[model samples]
Target chain A: MPRVPADSQTSAGFDSNLLAFTRELRAEGVAAGTAELLDAAAAIGHVQWSDRAAVHGALSATLAKSPEDLRIFEVVFERFFFRKAEETALQRGEEVAGKDPGGEQAQRIDLEALKQQIATALQEGGEGSLRDMARLAVAAFGQTQGGSGVVGVDVQRIRRSLGLRSEPQPDLPPEDARAEGVPRDRLREFEREVRRELERQTIERTRSLPPARPLGDLQRGLPTGQAADLAEIHKVVAQLRRKLATSGQLLKGQRQSSAIDVRRTVRASLQTGGVPVVLHQRPKRPKRPEIFVLCDVSTSVTSASIFFLAVLHALHDSFRKMRSFVFIERISEVTELFDRERDFKKISRAITSDAGVADVSGYTDYGRVWLEFLKLIESELHPRATVIVLGDARTNGRPAREDLFGQIAARAGRTFWLNPEPKLYWNYGDSVIDSYSEYCTTFECWTAAQLGDFVDALANPRHLPPSK
Target chain B: MSNTPKTAEELASRLTADGYLADTQTALVAWLAIKLGKPVLVEGPAGVGKTELAKSLSRVLDRDLIRLQCYEGLDEAKALYEWNYRKQLLRIQAESADSGWDKVQDDIFGEEFLLERPLLEAITSEEPVVLLVDEIDKTDQEFEAMLLELLSDFQVSIPELGTMTSRSHPVVLLTSNNSRELTEALKRRCLYLWIDYPEAEHELAIIRLKTPDLPAAVASRLIELVAEIRGLDLKKPPSIAESIDWARALLLLGADDIDAKVFRETMSVIVKHRSDLDTVAERVGVKLDGGDAASAS
Candidate 1:
């Protein structure tokens, strides 16, 4: 039998700080489960605690599962471990009245002196000193915009004054540009440190964690209307795709050709004296549902629509037919653009700029879009089509045209209205979700997780829709 | 006994001695995998030496490398173990009619009639081994699910013969190109190590170590140009392997300088895709032409 690894807290007593750090990582949307936490805690015993990078690596290998998670881990590691301690020290300085806290109270920075320090740090090429220089630069130059006390680093001002830009300036002579190469490269590192420091301070002051999503809660809903990074969204999309594809949910009501019917083949072989002469395969099922996606391309719901359309485009092959339409007031078919461009960003750009889907007002008018679709494209809807509407349902107080939507919904097999706005905000303002919910399935489509749930419900034939 | 490194720093040095310039993170992760007795899932863009890390670990630890190249339709019979059905049939036929039924059944199902695939071979080997599962993302979920039992327990179960456990603990490394997201169950059981492209300095050191004959200055220029080319929007960016190949090509040509002409002549060594050639030439060409002008002055 394989030897069981030692317990996470073997010799040293369990540190509550590590537990809190893992919680913070979870809050930031990393799926750092109990198993990973134990691994990380156990990993601490193997690495030297004094060597920060070594500890970081050990914890990262155990806790972070992907590059995206690693990015979050890097930010959280620096802030939670290093920045928190320094902040406490600064608070201690505050308690001591006039005594300086490691010279961190340099409010008005002398530009030339800071530049000299950066240049010296660059020349020495020591990462430790460069980090110290970043702290110094952020303390001296970082300002509280409009006295709100929200820490924002003034990177451009510092970089311009220090001549740290890498691009060759038209005014600067060629040799001068070449001479600034080393400093330019080092300045990028310095700027990264500044940003990290700024993030740490901002998070500290706000007393709230940044939007993080754990991957384990894909079926559960996410924070509504929050913008996630493209890569994170893509990861969630890929995971959802793998789950939906493998679970055979997408194969519902569709013909799957691979598996043979042994019983049927045996029964058919009886005609040939049980010699298995003619093998029989399972008969094909009914065709998969066609999908019609009508998305709101207004600025508020554009990201959600992009995600929705991207997911649809990815699973386009599984369905019988898939068509997409985008509208700001004027509705236009973007299925051709989705077909032509493989990248979601390009499709989003085309819908906004080149697809001629926007009106003069640039405001989302749900009634007008529905009316236009009803007039121009109602006949194209298949009887077995799944009509999905992706929007906030904020129709700018215009006529919601529930009658027209009901007509569209009655003609199709099923209709799903995904509102990017939170459920609490639904029907409070210009949102006509209450009127439309009576006619079709309505879901609060805020996060990618919710999108995955909606897709699951849409693909799984056994999953019944919510009661109207 | 296995020669696993006592510490991460020692592992780093050992890997360096094996000619794999692992950064601190890679070294620490690999060491922790060994220390914790877990598999390391190494993921990154293609050509970042994810497979090479497994090989270097095998060499450094004096373990035999047992590789399983995963592809589409990879299944239990190919990956774990397969019954030698033809041999079993022949054995059954060769047995005398007078032999008892139980004797014939046991004789055909014996170990001699078993064909050991990579997983079973690694488990059954007497010496310590390094199990490298390459391009794991290419395989589907069923294959991945089949691996979960073997990965977690280091054992495989054959219905006729029962479970076959490992004699020695083998170091396991699974490399992925991140083409698809692997199931969380597989990831949870393994230590994750993501190897992105190395930094310019690290790449320089790698070039120096891998191609000692190439002039250091020329290698630096080639790496810098390659970095520039990577910045362009290309279908396939030149990876570290391509960088080393470019360095070896330059050394073979006895080219001291990489001006626009030398770069144009040997650019195909790195840029593989035909569609990317125009874009790379248009973008990286400017850098080389500028370098040529600077050299002339």
Candidate 2:
């Protein structure tokens, strides 16, 4: 649990409300785990409670880690924090009792009867009637974002089984609720209340019915550094890719060549009475940066390094030169392996279980890996190239060849060190950060936010200055 | 005058005086960070002035702005503190050959050879310090982890020299361009602030402030046009810095307003990517040259 700030003097009622709201968010499939909820509570303890934006902004910084999570969080936040539902209800002095208690709300549409009626319509040669009903059924209930290969949406299943439609659109908020001029927060509040009502009714109406997957589940994944399995990690990385792809920042090198250069077009056409005929672009694209990634696939950094590599592969278009190296003891170039295998599981398996990267000791050597990888890339290393070395930096009693790192720092535009271990362990035993600290900036990147921010910087280096 | 801001509004006003127009949220966050003495993690896209805020804070508060520029391979020697190894080695060598190792230990690791990097300097400074950890996401994870200790408690523990604490706590502002996600532990240690591209009006104020000689008509048109270009699905969006550059570029080219020819010639200033320039030019051509043709079509 997050330790509440000592200065906090919030009412007990506010704390309970915060917890209940967290539960609602969790029910909506935002993996806003225990730690995050505690952080949220602590966050609320500060600032004037009357300040809506401050509360929202602080909670947002703590809770929303991804775009989809941000979306769901915004909805849940409106429903919980900014909500006037129960307040207005009590203020009106209206006895809104029962809320149609028991099986009343959930059984409004009987699935068994609806299925039977659709079957009958299909048998009666009124195919259009079945189509209309299916459309209506899907619109009323849930839908799927096709190609996920999960079971069809509950409403779409009866129709798809009858060979009506092959694909369904992604489940989004209702039309009236999604419409503009309604202030999205209010709509989100309405949507959540409606969904919560449906959920309560469904549980009451049919006690034995299996619950449908929440619409927001597709966007949620295992938090960074908590992926214990390989296949699951792949799925999370894929989700991360989708999130990044939808972001406004474009990975510049790909699909950028389509637009013609107009300034050059007008300049060269001055001889032809301002009628531009032949274009005069440089005929070359802007210089793309070379990124050399040296990953420490030591036992400690394996899981995180895989995630780092997966994200790098997902954003492949962002770099002109992308090279990857993995080192446990001896350094080996794994860029070809990553390019060849789209499946991270296959790549991870082949590299870790198959390849003999580990020396006889199965240990990490910061000294030899630094010296050896530099030797490999020294000739080809450009002053503009940015080399990223991801590892825990535990030298394991081997001499930390600090000079080679310094030498690489001299060769490349910049060198950065990413240690998966917490900073507390940076100097513990074999972790020799003092030796390598002189070369480049190091950061604690045990979270997805850090990795995402790193990729964002890589994709948009134009705004940054040349070198430190 | 109170060197420590008494209110968020005061800080905001002072920041504006320093030529940084922080919004209510940014002002509030900065105020809280200052009052609480916690590091403020300022995050946003590039050119949103995350670094500028720290600089402005230093100027406004009348403190030394200590900057630690982060990149890959940045380690303690560069970031936190570096022992003058050559001096230490020379000192040890110059000492009596028969002297014990413990005899010269205090002499080598003392304050003289202790070269304080940004982090150590900020922590150990006698006066007020504003530490700007710029582009923190560009550095490695190890560097990120190292910041956690310094950020959490304004102190550092050295093996040779023992623990060093600050006389006056520095106002630490760590900025990231969303290059990488900083960990929860790190975020939890500080207040968070994110800055987006300013709306038209604020940007206009900035443009006028930057280029005092530019015509008001041209500046408004330029802001409107840049906002439109940003709306387009271009590779690299034009940032405020680019907008200022474009304003300057227009003034140099002697264009009062963004006519087609002037816009076409000066498009490169605002648009970094060739593709965006092409798109902007075509749009201009349609709006300016194909006015009747577009209407007829």
Candidate with maximal lDDT: 1
Q: What is the DockQ of each candidate?
A: 0.32, 0.05
Q: Measured by TM-score, how close is model 2 to the native structure?
A: 0.52
Error of 2 at A47 (Å): 2.6
Q: Per-model TM-score of chain A alone? A: 0.53, 0.47
Query: How displaced is residue B127 in candidate 1, in Å?
Result: 0.9
What pairs collide in candidate 1? A28-A212, A29-A212, A29-A213, A29-A214
Instruction: Give the C-alpha miss distance for residue A280 in model 2, angstroms.
Output: 62
Minimum summed lDDT over a 10-residue window in model 1 chain B is located at: B288-297
Residue lDDT tens for model 1, B185-269: 9998889999988889999999999999888899899888888787655778899999999999999999998987788778899
Best candidate per DockQ, number? Answer: 1
